[model samples]
Target: MRTIQPIPFRLLLSAVLLAPCALPAQPRGPVGSVRGTVYDSLTRKPIVDAVIEVQATAQITYSDAQGRFTLDSVPLGVQQLTFSSATLDSLGLYGFAREVDVTSDTRGVLLTTPSFGTMYGRLCATAGSPSRDSAIVFGTVYDAASRTPLSKAQVSLRWLQSSEGGKELSNPERTTATGDDGVYGICGLPADVALTTTAQHDAIVSGAFNTVVGPSRMLRRDFYISRELGQAADVRTNATPSSGSGIVRGTVRYERGKALPGALVSLIAGNRSTETDAEGQFRLTGVPLGTQELNVQQIGRGGVSRAIDVTARDDGTHDFVLRGTTVLATMNVRGKVGADQAGFLRRKQDGMVRVVEREEILKRSDIGSALKRLPGLRVAQKLGGTVIEATRPMCVGQVPIVIDGALIPNPRNTTTFSVPQALSGTTAIPRATTTPAPSRAAQSSVVSAANNARVDQLMVNDVLAIEFHPGPASVPMEYWPGPPPQCGLLLIWTVASNWDK
Candidate 1:
């Protein structure tokens, strides 16, 4: 039986071929890899948490602390890589993009994008009527040692704007933050969009987190950004590593013979200026060391100009007086009324004068609210809301308003000048006169209230009557220093009828 088996050559051949098929095919090696680093151009530091995406495959990879990233298993080909960072972007870096080449079989490539440095600044306005969505966020983030672009740093933004009618509005303008690479930008603003851009340094603290402003500091500054009535624009933010700067300190005053309260003071060295407080005092800080032209003006009164030479250690103090020429009239009130001599009292409390009440000062749409209702008088917030001046104006400092007979300290910090004096009660309404100035007994009571921080500067409950003193239409010889500057006439109000009447 063993000898009967016959071997077939065909079967033997088939067995050999089948044996080869049983062997396993080796797994294909990875196609290729894409690699890159997100870094600041200036510092050469890596950017972490930056999102890098492959445009073709829509695959994404986040950069690590060293700003290094790799996309594995990428098919061999040209790939577009997109980079994006946080929206609340930092001062240094923004976003970037580039095309990368990938070879087949485990080959990886690297990409370097542009770095962005950043700057910081603020926004301000001339008048009380505020502008909206006004500000610029621009700057370049750079390396501390090489002064190169530092594309990966965080930056934040906060802002405030003035309100219309000198009244506080509920919401101030707010904006979303932005990110960066070698360059950064965030712009889309309204007429009020003038801002001070500040840059935060990674290793350099002096120029870092400091504000960058206009033409005077142009060598180390980017540009002056202003928002026209209706347009979208951006202002540049540029800053250097130096910190030595000059400052201007002083108070603003009316040329007319008296103190000006609530008069705004604007200081302009180069496109930058801030308003003073009710006392007419102001400070222009961090001014680049140089010669600067300073223009001081009472919004509605009259503006005056001066030139100042600034130095690194300079804390220059200068005062100014604006003139009033033209005057506003009684016709501007909501309900047009003629001039009236009778003083009005607030309906709430009998003893308290209406004008002395905070309600009287704040309730109306403009400064002339209560005054307009009275006969023969009108009021307006003019000087484009910069100055709370009146027409048929009184002499400089001629109008005085006293809270409790004595002047109230200006809320803003400055000593050069006190607030504009309110008109005297007796002068405003001949029939109604102010109560006598506080005697020693009254002073003692005031002291007690002040100690408890309960002193009533503008207590709503204690008001009695308000008096408006009408000034002459023309400037008098006494009101001028030499020759009266041309200006509009303004009326003044004196508070002091009787809060406790």
Candidate 2:
């Protein structure tokens, strides 16, 4: 160039650095993408908001409402795609993963939760025969109120199986512990048989969650647990298992056609019971939590006993199917508390106690209604059942109930259960040292939970008479089996007194 002779080395370097000429394009490694859809194995429905990750890499994407996802600029080569979501995380399930070749956009990739095949492979790996005869139970245990996963929850499963030698055997109880993910699984269970399962965490335990895995051999049951009212836990004590209670509502009907009205239902060994309404529907509350046996009274059918698993999140529903006539009849006192008609008349004529005669009982629909006829009693609708208390308004608005002189146990006696043990890997609720004074609602709820809805079980036809003692002064020794209640006693006269039992 002009005057370029004898240019300095420094000047030549500066010119090259300042030059605007384009050099050969630098090379880059190949980059690809991943596209796929996520779904639920049980429902076979698309799962939205699932996060897909290119493992060991920085690329990540989330599925849309349609469960479709795409990840661009994934380094080309073999890559691991992981899928996780709130739904999966809450179940304590680690996300699913797959190895994918990422030479180009990997499209049409489908994913799902642990499918039947996958679960089978994992559960039945050591089981014999690779057959679908054995069932697999998998689910998450969670807090009933918060709906959050409960870590370290214990799930108990019990089932009866037939052994190879034609012998009926009770399988060793299968129990599994849940991790922080609250996920649990049991494999190789007998298919097409009823299995009872319960979940427990510290002082909180769920009612029985009975399930049946048919020939399909896949059961997904999500159990919910809660601390029942009247239970108190202290960090100093080991949490005892709760015999939690729940409300069971259902209808009785003839399997062939319509509702069976006036049908009587009672919890076996539990006085908290009820009778079906005119519509054949009944709502029974405060039944103990767990697998409870129910006795249904029907004429000529014998007393039918049915097993129902009472859960914390009870569907609040049940349906009883009867085969015979719906022409309701008198209750069977086989093992129930009944009355002595002679003694009832004797008490009535003595005039020492307030007596509700059959003529009055027959006019009302149920005993609770008949009890309302008494002037010294307070009857109020609460928690889907009739609650009776003395007009004195003491004793927290509840009185100990007696039927046929059989004193029903008062739930208020043991209002406090044990606290959480805080076992390893378990996330327990913290014990509160200080609590605000309970509101009236709280007070009412405690009373309601402690009192049984006895009105639902006895219809007017079943009762010959009823007696009420308004105070300790009037509670006779025969009626008050235990310490005389401050609020007095109620003696219900049934068709057959337990004296016959």
Candidate 3:
């Protein structure tokens, strides 16, 4: 270097060309990393075996059982992180896309996933008999694009009954994992009603929905899933003659003023009948549009018939009032229990219990008003709608509103229902009326109701009975399925009649 002659042009160019291959690769400028844990937004529990991938990079990793993931050698700049898992997708839980910065080694990043809407379909071998005892709903999960059945796919089946007064039913029986055949099934399902199925596979897009186990004795419904995130599969089913139908809504009441719960409201010419709810409300869906005959009957009050004009859209409300005494002559109380007797026995059996009958519910326009009649329960207005609170204070998540046997999840917490401010009377407020602050319990119920909006979906006329237990100690074993609520429990039972023909 001290006295060397100048290098020739060709040799200098050659050295310059080889320079990039030498010099220790410039030390890579301190490669960065990213780490985080994935969690279920609803359950707030860590997800296990979830996968994490870096966009625009070869770095990818799977989450440990604790839902923890780590990626090293990430480029030092803004980077997008994607998460996925099969277990989560089957339950309708979907991961969120996150934009993360990798300027340095990052840690403790929390990613939450929300549940996607469910889809519904039916599986049957033939169209003649849709109901089969011990019938199996089996299907294969395949790559949407590749058309290959996925292995280790998770298929879950849940009952799709309406929550008595809560959110949609989420009663899972068991989870079936696909094997090398990529096939799964749930047997011994009740053939009387439809069932819901969900599918999930690692890094594969999943879907959930209620499925109609059609009459086909050995029908199969296959699901093709995609790798794209945040998308739910659309529900598909065979069309029926009554596919394009409408709904009929209304209330049945005693002539005096009381709403009639438990009254048999049937379509005269059709094989469809349902009992009125605690609010004396009733809804008949899948009703063919046009003129329909309605028949209302109660054991003691007798029966009445009327004609209703229905349309394909915009549900119509009808009110019926019977001209008879509310009291039924004391009979042996045989056969099915009468609506009035059901309400009376519920009250007579327990002094602490507060019963909301159809008659009372029908009197009120909203569920909040119907609940206000319960002792020690207060209803207050909020930004969304009226919230129910217990006069006796309780801890967090103590009071759970149960419909039928399923607990109603708070609508606010679920994506299923959206509480319209309009329904809660929170949209337009009058300056003259000053609303008081809601109690903690009341605020919680309101939020729960708003979040779940199950109460709002309940037509007073569809409720058969409602029972309020002030606290855990008061809840009956029959009504309390899982753990007892810490605060109190609201029980709602809907009318389920065997009128389907």
Best by TM-score: 2
Which portions of model 1 show Cα errors greater than 4 Å? Answer: 1-168, 171-183, 192-295, 298-326, 330-406, 409-501
Q: Which residue pairs collide in model 2, if any?
A: 92-181, 239-419, 244-289, 274-456, 274-457, 275-456, 338-496, 338-497, 339-497
Model 3 has an lDDT value of: 0.53
lDDT against the true structure, per candidate, is 0.37, 0.58, 0.53
TM-score of 2: 0.37
Model 3: residues >4 Å from true position, as ranges? 1-132, 160-172, 229-357, 360-501
Tens digit of per-residue lDDT, candidate 2, span 1-501: 011111122232223221223223323578887888988774467889998877656467999999999998877777677788887564435647776787687898886676656655544454444454677667777776566887777777775445577333333466767766677666667777657566789877664423576644666677666665213111112344234456888888877769888766765322345778988899866654544345565533323445555565666677877655233235453553323554454444544367888897898776677777665577777665677776442134466665664555433343322232211111121222323335556555664532254445667887777788654434554443323444567777565454323
Residue 264, model 2: Cα distance from true site in angstroms: 3.6
Ranking by lDDT: 2, 3, 1
Query: How many steric clashes does model 2 contain?
Result: 9
Q: Pick the candidate with the highest lDDT.
A: 2
**What are the RMSDs of all candidates, in order?**
24.7, 24.0, 26.8
